[model samples]
Target: MTSTADSYFVCATPRTGSSLLLGLLESTGVAGRPQAYFREPGEPMWAGRWGLPSTAGYDEYVRAALAAGRTDNGVFGAKLMWGTLDLVVDRLGAVHPGLAGHDVELLERAFGRTRFVYLWRDDVLAQAVSWLRAEQTRLWEADGEAEPGGHAPGYDAAGIEELVERIGEHNAAWERWFASCGVQPHRVRYEDLDADQTGVTRGILAFLGLDLPEGRKIAPSHRRQSDELNAAWIERYSRESARS
Candidate 1:
């Protein structure tokens, strides 16, 4: 049976302000909790937290996901990266019937008239720097979850350069996928979201056909991870990139 819940997906890349957007969306209390449900590295951790066996089959996993991921307003949201899109779709189809074919067909079958949100960063250099720093520090989120006393590694020029190329490739892949699917997603830029989170959040809610609750306050649960170090790295990388 097809679920009657409203469904949406955030097509994003790393260091693209997706976490911040997700935090803002969840704060609404009406918008569903959007997250990386099938991210390979995070799947085991999530399964444990959800009280499922690490080796649980696709059907079991998806059932738990539907149970835990849906919000009170019957909205189901998820964030997807281009790299894992095929794998996630394949697994979802294996467990959930009618989602077993092409990308657009699967999405339509599984979610039934789903909405798409495309989130991206225009500053590739800054995006690469943030991405590299997070990899070095293993501090993906600024929510006080990072292990204390780990020395923040110095920036490596080569690493940042490599990441820049990779991030660009991933962003291009997202664009190609959208074009192939013939979908026009609601776009949200990282800079715009960072500049005015509340306004952007409201815009997203309106796009999703959700009304903000009266007298409710929305705030981000996580802080920006960029700092002085990010600025320095970006500057250095820009100079190096310019020379090469």
Candidate 2:
């Protein structure tokens, strides 16, 4: 079944401040609940939260996700990492008969004329360090979510360098995907959001053709995860990379 809801996606890479963007968007209460709706480890958790049975089919999961995710204003949004885009498309096709066997064509079929927002980080080194630390600690966010327990392992230069290359590759893939699909996404940089959260979010609302009440402002719900540790790792990794 084709959905009539206005939909958009935040096409992102890891450690690109997507969590912060999603929080700011949700704060508007009109931008829809943008999140990693198809991410693993969280998908099953969302299924349980949405009250779906273990044996529920993909269609049922899609319906539940949309029902829970769409805002009252009829806008639905989701954050998609390039890594999981295929899985999302496959599941979407399973539910929407008209969307089968097409790459991005399925997106329009499932969510009528979807818009895309590309969020990326300019500082790849910092992003790589942040991703590595988060993976080690399993603390992807800092919004009072339960601490995953265990100290973050000491940084390894090789690991950070590998992640730097991987992040670059993934980001390049996103670029290629957009180019091949012939879609121009509204671009947002992590640095811009970090500098002015409210202004950036308002700009996004305007891009989406949505209006907010006069004088309305919502602070981001989550804190930036990067800290001195990230800075230190970046310095260490840069030195190692330069030496090698």
Candidate 3:
């Protein structure tokens, strides 16, 4: 199948439904296997998982990531969080010194015909609440797996407020970078994705110029993590924030 974009990255912040979006895209089997390959702190761990030595150079890491992310049709996908954008770009610069000063060109050199998908939540409060809970619980997704050291998450309005600010800052950074690059990413809102998982997934395939195979079904790999307590936190934050 001829693809419009050879590679794509899901640009996102935490608690933005990125896992769900990536899962839906991956389920199609045409879209690349999107995962967070360049998270700065997790670089060493990812390298280990990819069979790359800890001392592997940046270029080698990129190669492994590309090979791991690409589908049989030669389409590559990855998730790029705002926090790790700088590290990825700086490393890419080392590989291509000539394009060191150019972020977009640097990306294109490594990942051909690259596209960006901006995944975010419209409701900051809800996003913040979800992020705080995930951090405390160590359960980032509902995939029946978890990072080590998980406990029952507790609610704290102050913590939620801090995350709300951080989330906003990260999002703004993404906007600034996009504007600087003059690149308009495909925007996917968490609410819209949650409401119409199949519709949103189809829209992304259409954007990529790939048709979902007839009879292929899209299902979220992870269940929704939010619950009544999450709702209460959001509501409480709204009330407290409004009063403040």
Candidate 4:
């Protein structure tokens, strides 16, 4: 049987393997076309790309998204970073006044029978390292290659430590929000996803009550970015942290 939810949101923090999961889900062809729709910075870009009027309001944008982010079967999906949730909720309130102050209700009103998938990293240190590198190099993915002469980001112990703490705080905030809404999100761990990506994805599809067609393939869009430099940094951080 399929999950009652016709829509789902992937709630995640940076470097939590959410991107990989989204890609895996999209490959199934039955799952919704998940996208980070509500990130404020990406709103205008998406709006213009979707051919919406420059003066379009939140409701119109959301309508466009509902059409764009769904499969033929009508399961809609979106992504939400913890930091972006508050602003998104406020704007959603403008479009749905009666549902304001009730985040889950607001979402259900906007998108029918919504569910949440919480993706988080098990190793904060490793996650922070990845996030730091992405932020510094501005190379979040292999497709977005840098200029030929782009320099590698050097190690910054303090920066990494700060990011680790921030990621924890964001994770905790997500927990609190879930608690406040009496929500028990489907939990996924980055380390587990990395170890057995296909299996993990199958489990999630089961959770969503989605059945991969017989003989359907689970394909990853991109390879993991971890490399020798990541390993070296991990070792250096371990040694330095132990001394301190």
* Candidate 4 structure quality by residue, lDDT tens digits, 1-244: 6766788999999888777888888888767888898888789878988999988898888889999999888888889999888987788898989888988888888888988899998888898998888877877776656534445788999999999899989999999999999998899988888889899888878878888878889887866887888778888998999999
Clashes (candidate 3)? 0
TM-score of 1: 0.90
CA RMSD of all predictions: 3.2, 3.1, 1.5, 1.9
lDDT of 4: 0.86
RMSD in Å for candidate 4, one decimal? 1.9
Error of model 3, residue 188, in angstroms = 1.0
Question: What TM-score does candidate 4 reach?
Answer: 0.95
Residue 116's lDDT within candidate 4 is 88
CA shift of 7, model 4, Å: 0.8
**Per-model C-alpha lDDT, please?**
0.83, 0.83, 0.89, 0.86
TM-score of each: 0.90, 0.91, 0.95, 0.95
Name the candidate, 3 or 4, with the larger lDDT value. Answer: 3
Error of 3 at 21 (Å): 0.5
The residue pairs that clash in candidate 4, if any, are none
Cα displacement (Å) at residue 3, model 3: 1.6
lDDT of 1: 0.83
